[model samples]
Target: MAIDLRDPDESYVSFWRERHMCTLTTIRPDGTPHVVAVGVTFDPEGGPKGIARVITNKHSRKVANVLAAGPEGARVAVCQVDAGRWATLEGRAVIRTEPEAVADAVARYADRYGRTPTPNPDRVVIEITLTRAMGRA
Candidate 1:
């Protein structure tokens, strides 16, 4: 069953606020999953109600995959595991290159990770509008 996280519970919110790593899965043009360890943040105030953002270089494969998926956005999934507790977020992701979007992503990242990431000319943010969330936690 899918959990709607637009109004997530305290436990769900807590899980995201705590420092934890997540694995992002994006689909390649050939229908394969390109999974990678990524630093992500849950922005309850950004994008739609339940948005998850990941920062990456414009040249990254995940960026390419999201862009290649076109205007409708790409199907993406992010999963985080901590011992017996785990959560998976399934959503539609879009690559945002606008300055404001990048700034917001960076700010959220800093808030979550406690450090500002070094600025890169090729930096971009992948904004995911979550549709389904599920897991033990």
Candidate 2:
């Protein structure tokens, strides 16, 4: 069963706040899954509201994949695991290239990871509006 993460429990929120690496999966044009390790942040108040954010280069494959999926956004999944504990987030992803969006993503990323990422002129933010969440947090 899918867990409602719109208002995740404190424990789950805490789990995400840790510096665990997450695997992001986006769909390739040929319908294959393109998975990559990414630094992500759980923003309960950002994006379209209650979305996970990933900041990456504009020319990256993941960003291209998301944009290729069209205006409604691409379907994506993000998962983090630590031994016996794991959590998965599945949602629709929208690529944001606007300055305000990028700034918000950068701030949230720094807040979670504790270091400001070096500014990239070609940076883009992938905003995932979760539809389902699962696993043992």
Which of the numbered candidates is closest to the native, going by highest TM-score?
1
Residues 1-137, candidate 1: write the lDDT tens digits.
Answer: 35657676778778887789899999999999999999889865555568999999999999999999999999999989999888888899999999999998999999988889998989999999988888776
As a whole number from 0 to 100, the lDDT of residue 133 in candidate 1 is 86
TM-scores for all predictions: 0.94, 0.93
TM-score of candidate 1 on Cα atoms, chains taken together: 0.94
* Clashing residue pairs in candidate 1 (N, C-alpha, C atoms within 3 angstroms): none
lDDT of 2 by residue, 1-137 (tens): 35666667777778889989899999999999999999888866554437899999989999989999999999999999999888888899999889999999999888888999998999999999987788777
Could you report the Cα RMSD, in angstroms, for every candidate shown?
1.3, 1.6
Worst 10 residues of 1 by lDDT: 1-10
For all candidates, the clash counts are 0, 0
